[model samples]
Target: MNKKAKIAVTRKLPATVETQLEELSDAKFNLDDTPYSEPQLIRAVSWADILIPTVTDQVNAKVINAAGPNLKLIANFGVGVNHIDLEAAEAKGIQVSNTPDVLTEDTADLAMGSFIMASRRFGECERMVRAGAWTG
Candidate 1:
């Protein structure tokens, strides 16, 4: 029988996603929602076939170099991969990926809202009201 692949997720993901991962693989999740310390991250990579990291986790060269042979992928949960060491992953032949478009719509909405609020001077009005400087 083929053994299920082991996956280690560094942060708390949605329950639906975690359930799916658990069903398909030997998945380990950080239910505490805290970012893994360096030693904890190293141990996860040492045994996992895949590592799911968020922006908070630093997947630097030291962590990459410590990964076992079975660790073939580092799938970042967020769009930015600044915390991960791309060069090291390349040298180690481990593929890296991220969910880039997931925040596109949300980002656009925030920008539009900010523009509207700024144009209307909402912040200034709110401050005046709070400071009791505005009436009628």
Candidate 2:
């Protein structure tokens, strides 16, 4: 059998996504269930052909530089790339891509719900209930 393309995932994802990737390539997920430190991230990027990263993870210039010649693409799972060093990736001729439009409505709905809850004193109501304020 031909060797599969090696990819590294920096965070835990749903099983469906894992299965999808596994069908096409060999994926290495973070086994410790913890975030990777800078040095660990650098080493993983150095060995990975593709990197799947989350927004909370920092992919700075140092990490980008250490990706070496094997790194071809970074397929970010989130909609934002603020945590990644775009200039450094460009300098190294590495391609960076992201999954956009997937969380737009979900994020917007969460923001709206949070705003309403904050405006309506929902926390105060919960506190009242917990404080035995029911008089009916």
Candidate 3:
């Protein structure tokens, strides 16, 4: 029997997605609370057949070059690809992909809620309550 492909997850992800990957391939997840540095990220990519990363993690040309020919896919967790150098990845023959429209509604909702709260002086109300100044 052929062995399953190995993948490296560069950051923490929701359990639902992680479970899906666990069923599909050999997945290694980073458990440390701290983020991985560039050198550490390069080392992880060197051994992976696929890489799963977040928007904050940068996958640059140097990192792609250090992949050592085993790396195949990069699946980003966010819609933005600013952190990745697509041209460099293409030049190195690595496939790159991102999750689009997944969190659009949620992000917009949160932004609207924050705007409402700020405009209504919600922070002042909370501060007054904490200071025992509620006369009602």
Candidate 4:
């Protein structure tokens, strides 16, 4: 922790987030915003102390096994950790972290939309509510 941790980000982050990460660590960003192939991902994992990968970036056992001793953490930039190989990471003494509940709002929005579209019978209720005509 005394020295700058080498961080490899597998995908592009927001400008502000990237800047902050760079300030904190020796961050290597995916400037082109291109998804890494499995081989490329292995190389990245083999080269850094920390890895920041998106949900779509599958960090499986093979990739984990190929990681170098310097690779200590995999900080997934998404809600689910299923994409990462937890068992492999544990065996390697590497910690895995993720952004939990990051898609709560999006999930709720999708659920509500699905509910509303479940039946067209609620169309009048929807219009009435929008028009401030619904008392209940």
Candidate 5:
């Protein structure tokens, strides 16, 4: 792999993963974890050979078009490719990839956790406390 191959990551990933990316390639990370604006997205695509966008980043036609000539891949961080314009990517000969089923177990665990929390009225209790309505 070319050490100069530029990879733009649109969100802050886990520290270990980010470290690996840094070690493996010329990875540019969005350490702030904020959603990229249209111009920022355009800039990222313009600069990167590959982009690692998350659910929050919209890889639309405009973004695809803004990609530099070297840009070849859009590797999404999440399972949903709906955020990306697949037709436009294909038209531009940019390959789009994603980690499908990546969140299956985590999503299920969160669902179950939320179910238990709701059943226990944990949110309501927190609200009560926040509102200074706790009697006990």
Candidate 6:
């Protein structure tokens, strides 16, 4: 890795991740923190050596095809890569990767919520509270 890859990040990530990416490559951040328009995505694909897209950024076949030959890697920031077109990237010889375990904490919290709701009958309690019938 003598030559640093020019990386384009599609959205605002956590500070730690931004720092790491900055250390690793010529990383560019989206300061606006908004999803890219289709034209902006196309331009990013053309301009960058690597593209770091979030779940909100849809990297479909059209965008992938618009990428320059310099574009080689698509390192998605989040768990889901369904927003990106796998076959398109493969066809263009671009490698695709993602953080699959990114939602582990979220999933665990959701599971705990479900258990607590069921065991305590929170739904019924909430209904009563909303109806002004809950004394407590």
Indicate which candidate wins on TM-score: 3
Which residue runs does candidate 3 get wrong by more than 4 Å?
none
Provide the global lDDT of candidate 2 against the true structure.
0.90
**Deviating ranges (above 4 Å) for candidate 1:** 124-136
| True lDDT of residue 32, candidate 1 | 91
Q: Local distance difference test, per candidate?
A: 0.96, 0.90, 0.89, 0.91, 0.92, 0.94
> In candidate 3, which residue pairs get closer than 3 Å at backbone N, Cα or C atoms, i.e. clash?
none
Sequence-dependent TM-score of model 2:
0.86
Report model 1's TM-score to 2 decimal places: 0.86
Please identify which of the two predictions, 1 or 5, would achieve the higher lDDT against the true structure. Answer: 1
The TM-scores of all predictions, comma-separated, are 0.86, 0.86, 0.90, 0.78, 0.85, 0.83
Give the per-residue lDDT digits (tens) of candidate 1, residues 32-133.
999899999999999999999999999999999999999999999999999999999999999999999989999999999999999999999999999999
Candidate 3 lDDT, tens digit per residue, 22-87? 998899998884567899889889899999888878898888888978888999988988998899
Report RMSD for candidate 2: 2.0
Residue 22 lDDT, candidate 5, scale 0-100: 89
lDDT comparing candidate 4 with the true structure: 0.91
lDDT score of residue 41 within candidate 3: 82
Q: Give the candidate number with the greatest lDDT.
A: 1
**Residue 4, candidate 1: how far off, in angstroms?**
1.9
- What's the best-to-worst order under lDDT? 1, 6, 5, 4, 2, 3
Query: How many clashing residue pairs appear in each of the predictions shown?
Result: 0, 0, 0, 0, 0, 0
Instruction: Give the C-alpha lDDT of model 5.
Output: 0.92
Model 1 clash tally, residue pairs: 0
Off by over 4 Å in 4: 113-136
